[model samples]
Target: MPVQRPFNFSAGPATLPEPVLQQVAAEMLDWGGSGMSVMEMSHRGKEFISIYEQAEADLRELLAVPANFRILFMQGGGLGENAIVPLNLSRGGKVDVAVTGSWSRKSAAEARRYADVQVVAEGSGRNIPGSANTWSLRSDAAYVHVCTNETIDGVEFHELPRIDNGVPLVIDCSSHLLSRPIDWSRVGLAFGGAQKNIGPAGLTLVFVRDDLLGHALDICPSAFNYKTVADNQSMFNTPPTFAIYVAGLVFQWVKQFTYAGLQGLAAMEQRNIDKAALLYTTLDASSLYENRVEADCRSRMNVPFYLKDDALNERFLAEAKAAGLLQLKGHKSVGGMRASIYNAMPLEGVQALVNFLKEFEARHG
Candidate 1:
């Protein structure tokens, strides 16, 4: 038997649902009796095509995606989409960005390379803007961009900003894609890397409203063109076959998930709520640790906290690993600790971490 794995808390390329992993392992050698692994199958082959179609369909159902939106499984993670989005949607016109934290700031910086990007609203790097009304969006802006969840900053937008100027709202939801239901009426495009909430790293999921598909900047690569990929059913070129297969299994697992009498996405949202609450409650109650993000904007997926005594960082990480809680270190820029309680992180995992935090604080405090 394999060694029991520790609870993973990495920011991205994060943990996946256990059932999805087990199914992937079981199908590694012979997927569906096809005598070939999903990785070995051709993207154009019928078997792989079925896997792609089912994954897209399941994701659509799980999220209740509107019929008018096209879901495209493309390459290039969130950072890549930072550029690809502005290139495809900006049309070399003004683009408004709401800088809530690190990821949104990066998105704004990258958009400047393709469009005349404007920082319509800014945060103090610890909280989201109080309201979308504070933004100074231009009427001619092609679209407004926001990172719905900042993995590094531990801040999430509980509600999406309303753009009343007829500008489409494009969100980089890399860290919190499937944790809960999305309001499609307020969104024009939402994209994310699969590694966090879905499956693996190479796959990028993009849901774009039909109206936003055809207006790519002339400099945009043909492969990255939304219209081209949507027209070909995300097969303008060879897709991420293995990642899509694993993601398909994850979607199936998510569809069957149940918690507290809730099912599917409702179940997932409930569990995530419970997990984040448990962890945050522990941190808030402890004098030794602190989570600085505003409670209203706290992320249900990533939780970044700092030890009151910064000198204890090394010892905390070492003991955390010994306690089977891994990857609790914060991002380099942040310099503390982060616990990414994604959809795959069970309530028990958060409880375990809480127990460890209490024990450590008691021993050290």
Candidate 2:
């Protein structure tokens, strides 16, 4: 049997809620008397179709996604969408992107293959603008893309930007989806991989405005075309059946979540805010550990911190693991330690991490 642990702070392919995992385990052998594991079922079978429908419905209701937007269950992780977004939306026109950190930079570079990508705004995504007028958006640009949250740098855009030029705004909200409610009014399209707040790897969710459909460059694969996939209800190709089922369970779990008398994503959001606040506050107060990201722009999901003495990094990981906290290491590009407190992580988990941090500091101080 696998050992149970607590306080996981992994970046993607991250921790899942215990209840969701438990349900998955129980149904692994025989799903709903079908006598077949979900993984073994055909993607077109009744069991998988039921799973897909429930998953889609639950997600639509959870986000309060409008009728004008089609939710696609896609396969490629965020990296694949880096190209897909441009292929479907760019129309070979100029594309504008705000280069906040690693992910958006990659987006800009990939889009250059299909369109003229312009960096309208460049900075760490965390800070409030020195001046909003600094951006040079092209009136003829295909669409403006923003990361919204930089997973590696711990910078988050609390408010979505509004562009008056009529060009749609595309957001790479992969890291922070479901942590809080989205202002869909300002967003034209959004895509996120399910490894973070949703469920497991292999499931990608894309929400696109109805008016933006059917514009795919000839080079784009038929299965990847927004209109094609959306028209087929994400059946253009075989979907990630198992991952979708798990994500549906998570959606149900989120709906029943209660915090401060709120339910569903509202409750999840409040709890997430509280959990992030607790961890960030503790890190800020410690002299041994520090999070250098700007206060106003810090990510509520991924918190990357560093020890004043880098020599203690290995010891820190060993001790954190021994204390039942795992995957606290940061990304390789920006090395240190990172704590990803997504929606699945409860306030108690953050408290455990805080307690561990304090104890570690006291021992090494």
Candidate 3:
């Protein structure tokens, strides 16, 4: 039997599939007979270009990205995109944001620097505030932004919200990208960092509709300009080659993944649903632990829960670590525990975590 390795539940810079890690290891010194690793290759070299093309193609196919949307492999994480999105799409006009959690709140703050920022909807940081009619959406706004999944707050929008005004809808899906299929009809653009679910930090993915490309503000840098980056096939400046390579492998893995007769994105989404259900079920049953996010909005990717006794937090983390479950500690902003079950984390990993949770509660409850 293959020996078990530790299960990691970090929110970002999270776990990667063992097979993808192995493949990356095997290609460390030489990738497909190329003398240099992906990290060493020139960004403009044919070899790296081939890697870039394949990665982009695989991602487009896997996500079912529409023909009219341009896919960009970018640097800077979700945080940087907070500024980049406003610089490109805001057009120095009104920008409306739905502040559902920490990430979206940050997005609104960053955007205020470039546009007339308005908070259309505000959640309690735990629950999305209200229905669409309650959102004070402005018809003249350049775009409306939402973070479909908030990693820190453990809130998610199971169904993408509708923007009635035909204004573009931008989603910061850094935590849940590729875990499910996207509805292109409603989205004007989508962006995500490749860490939580895709592969690594430094790589960001942007999908922008054809019409949204050329409106970047005057201050937007050439490299950060979506139109410039898209025009150059994401090579306007040197892309994050290594991250893209690993993400490509992840995309391939997701495409071939199978579950309950579903394949690819469908398979991934179903598995994520099962994993989240398992952990949430365990938490709900335990008198010693509880998740605060509402049931309908709970994130399948990141789950933050609290132990009944805060004094036991340290012991819980240490015990979980010793049990081969890692990074169960929640974000510092929220004093509790979190389990980031990304695409790479198998059901077995979550089960191990569930078992550990039960044992810990039994001992300390």
Q: State each model's CA lDDT, in order.
A: 0.93, 0.90, 0.93
lDDT of 2 by residue, 95-197 (tens): 9998888899899999999999888888854464443346898989989999988888888888888877888999999999988888889899999999999
> Model 3, stretches more than 4 Å misplaced?
none
Q: State each candidate's clash count.
A: 0, 0, 0
CA lDDT of 89 in candidate 1? 95
Question: For model 3, what is the error of residue 191's alpha carbon versus the real structure, in angstroms, after optimal superposition?
Answer: 0.6
RMSD of model 3 against the true structure: 0.9
* Location of the lowest summed lDDT over 10 successive residues in candidate 1: 125-134
Model 3 per-residue lDDT tens digits across residues 1-365: 99888999999899999999999999999999989999999999999998888888998898888999999999889999999999999989999999999999999999999999999989987898777667999999999999999999999999888888888999999999998889989899999999999998989999999999999999898999999998899988888889999998998889899998999999999999999999999999999999999998999999999998999999999999899999989999987999999999999999999999888888899
Clashes of 2: 0
lDDT of 3: 0.93
lDDT of model number 1:
0.93
Show pairs that collide, candidate 3: none
lDDT of 2 at 135: 86
